[model samples]
Target: MSRRTVLVTGATGTTGSRVLAGLRQRGVAVRPASRRGAPAFDWGDQDTWVDALVDIDTLYVVPPIEDSPTGVPRGMGDISGFCKYAVKQGVDRFVLLSARSGRAGNPEVVAVEDVVKALGVEWTILRPSAFHQNFAENFQLNSANPLRQSIVDGSLEAMDLGSPIDFIDAADIADVAVETLVGTGHHGQTYELSGPRAFPFAEAVRIIARTLDRPIQYTEFQPTAWFERLRATGVDETVIGLVEHVLHSHDSGVFAGEFDTVERLLQRPPRSFEAYVRETAALGVWDMNQAANKAMQHQR
Candidate 1:
């Protein structure tokens, strides 16, 4: 029997990296496809696609989002074309990392989902909620890099979204993705993965403050103010727009939905916000002094 090789796109990203580790730990043959990874792949560069698809029967795709020069959110461009090419390459299975809100609110995600489903292959879609890692990794709070600065000093802005969000951990998303990729009975299924419970951003900040033993404040921000703050920090305009869109959707009560999909798939309750905060705090993810020093040095 020939060994099955799986290609993981966005291989170094939050969820993709975790998926790669999980696959490797399970003794699965895996190929990481990224602009920097071997057999490099770029969503905008079609020439790099074919080489990365070689000898790969399964694919784990996380669509790349890049900023547009026009300051608009650029969705995955031409995913249908890529799906067609992948089908021609004999790829038999696909797992797409989509968002719970995107299924209804974002046309680009809907189009990508449609393309993957039409491929006539085993496909599983993961629609996950806001990731808990955003606070420590993507969002401008407690980031380790000097180039990024916190949008708010010592205070975090919470969207007045009118409801609580069930932010899932990236690791839990990875676990479920691994199972869907390598295990049985998950084909043609769409799983909405979320944390065990929903809570407002103020509550989340309180949990983080308690876990980290620090004084962190959460202030409710209107959508316009949030957009301006992100823009002032030199964030990509497209990303800022997307953030505003999601915040508006949340305010409209779109992202408050929760599910037991994670528990059912992994046979364990998904990691909670408190647990994520505790683990991250242990790793010094919320160290204000370190972050302040880095920012100060960068300014010099």
Candidate 2:
């Protein structure tokens, strides 16, 4: 029998990129599928899907995100349709990346999970908490995002809501994804992965501030002001709405729970927020000079 080839969609994204690295370190054969990747797979283009799935035995699906409040990107092919096609093409197993927020009864998430289950194949769904990397890798450090200016200026703006979020490291999620992809006994399971503990966003910034030994001021915006701040930053309405909803949910204490799924699966405790802050600080992403340099580069 040939070695099983796994196709990983969104291979450049936070968790997807880590998943790719984890699989590679394990010597697993991986085919990365992205719009710009070698196989050139795109969710908006069905013609690109076949080549990405060819001879693949398993899949790691990172569903396409929406730019609209509807959670459906205009002109993107249906993911359920893609799953059906994959099953037809002899892909036997699937690991889907979803969010814990979806557990709150989001219709789009419900539909995706339903289709994956109906595929009649081995499947596992991972519903993880917010990623720890978001602080370092996403809008925080990316100079293209207007939010980076605040970080560079040593001001952290947020709609705190006093939520105790259980943020998981993307690497941990990747570890779990690799295990499920290469091992057995995880099929048909839905794992809720989170950090070892939960804390408010302000506390997380405090950890960072302490690590850097600099006063990184944390400012909480009221709902109206928060919405306006995002708009001033050129954030689209859909994302703004989603952020508002998530923050309100956080205020309602929807994501205050911590899960042991990471430790149980990896036989190691989840990495702490302090660890993330310390390690990320060493990278100088939060350094004023480094962040400003990145911002300048994006401007050019």
Best by lDDT: 2
| Candidate 2 Cα RMSD after full superposition onto the native fold (Å) | 3.3
lDDT of 2 by residue, 154-247 (tens): 8888775767999899989999999999888888998989999989888887888788898878888777887787799788897776666656
lDDT on C-alpha atoms for all candidate structures = 0.77, 0.80
Each prediction's TM-score versus the true structure: 0.85, 0.88
Tell me the deviation in Å of residue 109 in model 2.
2.3
lDDT of 1 by residue, 138-241 (tens): 52212343211232245675557777888999999999998888887888998888899888877887787787666766677676776777778898876666
Candidate 1: stretches off by over 4 Å = 1-3, 68-75, 139-153, 226-245, 293-300
Cα lDDT over the full model 2: 0.80
Candidate 2 local lDDT, residue 200: 87
Worst 10 residues of 1 by lDDT: 139-148
Question: What TM-score does candidate 2 get on C-alpha atoms?
Answer: 0.88
lDDT of predicted model 1: 0.77
**Clash pairs detected, candidate 1:** none
